[model samples]
Target: MGNSQRNDGVQLQDERLRGEQLRDEQLQDEQIRLRRPAGIRSLQLGDVKVTYVPDGAIRLTPRGWLPATTDDVWAEHAAYLDETGHLVASVGGLLVEHGDRALLIDAGVGPLSVPAEPGNAVGAIEGGALLASLAEIGRDPGSIEAVAFTHLHMDHLGWAHHPAPGTDGPAFTSADYLISEPEWTHRHLAEEHGTSEEMLAALEPRVRTVNDGDEIFPGVRVMLTPGHTAGHAAYVITGGGRRLIAFGDAMHSPVQIGHPEWWATVDHDTEQSTSFRRGLVEEMSRPDTIGYGMHFADVVFGRAVRGAAGEGARWEPVDA
Candidate 1:
């Protein structure tokens, strides 16, 4: 070969090698972003500050949890699965602070850990750091004005009724337990899921049933989007010209943004849940809105973006 031709060939080979290396690095970065659970993350919206307080995390068996999904689907999206092949989900509360007052959405899974059982959709689950997370933020449990629950699930009711670390009574004693009117009236149904009758009774004295559209807190309103449960509620907080929809369990994993039809095994009404999920994704895709998925692994706070032309929406994580 001519010397000039040889030089051109070598340059082309080096360019190809560099391109491959870059692609590999990009894939690795994407994997790291999806595989881990989130720590504490916060964002300021005008006068309101919203935070995702760390409690602990859980592993979900993808196939078992979302029964509609297939092995091929998971194989195509393996980056979402951890080393154990289960989806990593962070279990925590959304702390909304406005000036001196604070409102906590979902009290986390409390100070308990349950090991994964064979044939179960959920793998090992652990929680107990919510109180410590609050302390780290310099907010006392007593200062929280209300504990607004999306549903009566044990994970969302953690500190509301569970005794604080070593205390004899439940933490947040001074705060009213704000529950959706339907969720409170239909509390019995929650026992079928995971909530205990004892927990319901404990909250009876402090429970306050809130109606849809009620401004439970300043700049925060109740939005009833039931399907996962009889009364699953998503709180909408508006401040600083932007709004955040704290959609609890409405969409567990960001993967659902692309497949809203895949229902969790625990959903009360699969059809209703799927329908709501579709609309929720559309709303989250709006420019001025942010969605909070308490169990959305490391991307707990993100916005849904519509795909190019004919494609569906995808989740884009927002940095705190």
Candidate 2:
């Protein structure tokens, strides 16, 4: 072969080898992502220990979950979904511990799962691991001083009301179930959105109505973040010179941080939800600010960052 042709051939071979290596790296990355840890994860803010306990998971239908999203939007973010073509939403509680005292936020979806239906936002929902996860973290049900709910949603209050299958009574029976005042006053409205009357009755005795800014637990105060429900709330925990906002249903996934206008189908008021989400995005952007997205799949603890688009910002998971 001519010298020039031989040189060109070698260059082409090198390019092909580089391309193969890049593809292999991409495949390995995808594999690692699919193997992400699913259960309990912990982060420490100075002396406070925060854990995202896994009860189970729900498969969210892209369009059904967020009615505002179109197929085109889903197309642009196909990587977020699992193999089943569903967005895997973690369903559990956040266990916040400070010294000797412990406060459980959002009790998690108990041991019940429903199959998805034709237009359902969730394809399937199942949870029965909160108690076990707590036990794994060396926390007993009774150890929790109080169960502060972010909202009156069934998933958030499940373990509090639903009696364990093999146990005598409901878990956390000894502790008070702290609910937002407006949420408790207008409890009837939540029933339509799948919060059953049975659950309301079960939790009624232990319910304590707290208002916005109420300091129910040490270093934790309620912030009225409505729209997801009548009295949906977010808890702000400050300790060791840092702040972590356990923003409940205010944000279902990190993707919402990039698009505050995408309200959940379950949101009580879309306009109000968007407003709170926008403000939250800004709050999360500040230094020393971390957020706990209650339903964020694997990387539940993340911080919002200024996004490329004007929509707002995006959520970047914090390994700590």
Candidate that scores best on TM-score: 1
lDDT of 2 by residue, 84-143 (tens): 767778889999998878999999989987898887787888888898898898998887
- Give the Cα error of residue 11 in candidate 1, in Å: 18
Give the candidate number with the greatest lDDT: 1
lDDT (C-alpha, whole model) for all candidates: 0.90, 0.85
Off by over 4 Å in 1: 1-30
Which regions of candidate 2 deviate over 4 angstroms?
1-37, 309-312
- Candidate 2, residue 282: how far the Cα is off, in Å: 0.5
RMSD of each: 4.1, 5.3
- Which RMSD does model 1 reach against the true structure? 4.1
